[model samples]
Target: MQNSATIASDFAELPATASRGPLRIEYRWINDAAADTRADTRIAVFLHEGLGSIAMWRDWPQALCERLGMRGLVYSRPGYGLSTPRAHGVKWPVDFMAHQACDVLPALLDALDIDMPARQRTWLIGHSDGGSIALLYAARHAGALAGAVTIAPHVFVEDISVQSIAQTKQLYETTDLRNKLGRYHADVDSAFYGWNDIWLNPAFRQWSIVGELAAIREPLLAIQGHDDNYGTMAQIDTIAQHVPHARLVKLDACGHSPHRDVPDKLNDAIAAFIASQT
Candidate 1:
């Protein structure tokens, strides 16, 4: 196994073989120290939050991959970062997360030539909406996944989520949140409204993947912050009930994003969990 010292970045174009049409995905690969000892088979994929892009993830994926000595992939979804923007007047559906989990993510892996065999050694590390997507994908594609680590994931809609989302929509209109997020997105509105609009939709309140999570059979680690404003302990707690083998960790004083709030502790916990599984 060769350990490199460079981070590779590029774009993968998906031909319109699926219903979502053609898309360009911007991705970054952190390969420095990727193949440590006999751990070359291990691969980590980082999925960002609802409004996150490759730029927004910054260096946390790289930091975690360095800690584990594994190759890591981080990418922007269709309507985020430098990837294709949402078409004008297109409103996201209530099941947008499902479409992302079922369609977009699989296509991305395929386009990158990550076959099912390789997926057996792949770990999906996701946060917020991305965390939910990771669970949804693992629910149906357990055979293709080694395991999953969800940070502040939601299995069901809650009143708290609605309130936060509503506040965010207001911030986007009345404040400089749009300009600030523009630093990470080529089309800020595409990334923001696409996620914000869907979450605030009245129909989305009924969207729940709690029942679907029972399909996940791989090792799972569910982590959440004790003081998260968007969702509460019920999120990760529900995951533990369905996935009896899932390990749970609640970080005190940590908010919605544990990686940002407590990077060192989070990294150690994840590395230990993966080591124990192996």
Candidate 2:
């Protein structure tokens, strides 16, 4: 486990356009150190949390890419990071995560010229809400990916998640949380409120992805922290039950964000998993 986190690297955004929507999206590219010397390695796509952005991933993605000799693409969703913000007063629906996986991500990938079945298929590494999106995408587009790694993914909404989010909402309003998060997002309010409202909405309590996970045929690695405030072991347990080929890792003293809390262990586990699959 790492004692401290690395500083986030500065990232530049390239506008990615697609027909499904998100006229413009934000993305960054990290070339492998040996790109000039070796053939391209597999592509690793890093999807941030509901409230996360490309910058929030800090140096973690680059570190992982360096270890595996893989090329990396880290991007911010429409309402986070330097990406486009959500329209005013628009609350994400219960199926919002689904939309992100099934529509938004594919379009963004296309815009980036990452065509599947032609060029190298990408591997997905997602955190928190991003993890859930990864699952959905793998389920829907199993043939398009090499594998997936989900850190602190949610298969279903839990009371603990709702409660913790409520606390974050309070903190955002009362503390410096907003000011701090603002540094990572273009529109901090849009990023925070967009994620917070949907999770807290009464209708969202029944949202679940357990049924959809069975369709995913790609090898998957589900990781979670034992002390994660937002979810429990049941999340990954359910994933294992649904995706028979899935692997699970539970870390002690780690929180919701394993990439941040136990980076060394998380990176090692991820590298091993990817190696086993490749």
Candidate 3:
């Protein structure tokens, strides 16, 4: 396999056939390596957190892809980055994450012409809300993925999560959180309000994907921080209980984001796990 020198960036507009009306996605191709190696390579698709966008991931995805000598596809979900924003006054439903996994993500891959079942099955690396989306996708389309890695994923909404979200709403209104977040998003309001409004919705409190976990037949690596304020060890533990071959890792001194808090350890663990699987 030829190893390239740098990452490449591109965008794809979903076609009418994808059923996702006029959506444009911003994506990055990291560690392109070489054209000759494309056929045999397994691509890692990185999905960002709730408020995260392509730029928000910064250099982490590229760093990991380089470490593994793997190519990676990192994209911003609609409404999060330079991608299409949610229409004004529109609200996401309780099963928004499912919609993302089953519809948006598939449409994106299709738009990019990356066939998942045609010897191009991907390795999904997702964080927080993205992690939950990864789990849903793996369960619904088991054969499309080689494996899944979730960091700080939430299978069920917790009271602490709600409380933290409430505080974030306050920060958005009172502090400079909006301005700070604006650097990473094209439409700051669309990203923050869309995520904040949904989680804080009363009906969302009952949202749970516990039943869906059992259907995830692919190997899983569930990582979470012992000190995470948004979720607890139960999140990863429950996943392990259902996914027979699942592995769990709890990082000490790391809060919600192990990638950011302890990237070296996180990358080592992920690279080793992916290598073992292959």
Candidate 4:
């Protein structure tokens, strides 16, 4: 099976005129199984970071999907990459992640004709903002997920995280970060500001999903780097404390991106966790 990221890159390498959808939501199949394959096979969905898109994931999703013998789906959220751009002047609400978890994701699945069984066994692999979104989804739609792997998820805002985000704002305004992000986002401002404004809002500082997590009964694997600049280990630690069967893995010499920073270890850990759930 090719990783979903590699498939996405190949799609991106195609002519710009290639039509996907209104939002250019490119959905690719990673496994070569027949369409009528048994539902017992796991399907992993890749959710990108705050600044990520389907293209930014490189070959990691594909590799992980193959390693786990699972089908994979990767898509750029609205306003990112080939996805449809958000309307001008539209701002994300404070509970944007909640909306994604409660609404957008389910709709996306429905559109793709992916039905959730009474006891579904799918996995969610989410990074950064996507990780938080995954947690919210798992909390509300517990029957839809068998396990989840979150890398560098933020449960609450920390002083360090705020400071780092402030620095990012400076970089976006005064440095090449904006130009760099433009490569992945059609509306860079929408993607950046939507995430930034929400996290920086005063009311958002009180945003914590620990209560929701406490209600999650599914297995979870929370991985974080000890040296992550954007968030602290406390994020995953908090998940472990709240979610009944949550497992925490702290990676050394890693940063906010465990899949990118420690691919082999991260993949092994995720594969093992998924296998145990099966």
Residues 134-195 of candidate 4 have per-residue lDDT tens digits of 89988898678877889899888888888888889989999999999898787888778877
TM-score of 2: 0.91
Q: After best superposition, candidate 1 residue 165: deviation in angstroms?
A: 1.0
The full ranking of all candidates by lDDT, starting with the best, is 1, 3, 2, 4
lDDT of 1 by residue, 132-188 (tens): 999999998869989999999989998998999999999999999989999988899
Q: Candidate 1 — which pairs collide?
A: none
**lDDT of every predicted structure (CA atoms):** 0.88, 0.85, 0.87, 0.78
lDDT of the structure predicted as candidate 2: 0.85
Single out the weakest 10-residue window by summed lDDT for candidate 4: 10-19
After superposition on all C-alphas, the RMSD of every candidate to the true structure, in Å, is 2.7, 3.4, 2.8, 5.0
**How do the residues 82-159 of candidate 2 rate in per-residue lDDT, one tens digit apiece?**
777887688898999988898788777877767765233578999999999999999988688988999999999999
Which sections of candidate 1 miss by over 4 Å?
1-8, 35-39
Using Cα atoms with residue i matched to residue i, what is each candidate's TM-score against the true structure?
Answer: 0.94, 0.91, 0.94, 0.88
In model 4, which runs have C-alpha deviations exceeding 4 angstroms? Answer: 1-26, 33-39
Where does candidate 2 stray beyond 4 Å?
A: 1-22, 118-120
- Per-residue lDDT of model 3, residues 105-145, tens digit only: 88888877787563235889999999999999999996888
The candidate 3 region of ten consecutive residues with least summed lDDT is 1-10
lDDT of 1 at 65: 87
Ranking by TM-score: 1, 3, 2, 4
- Top TM-score hit: 1
What TM-score quantifies how close candidate 4 is to the native fold?
0.88
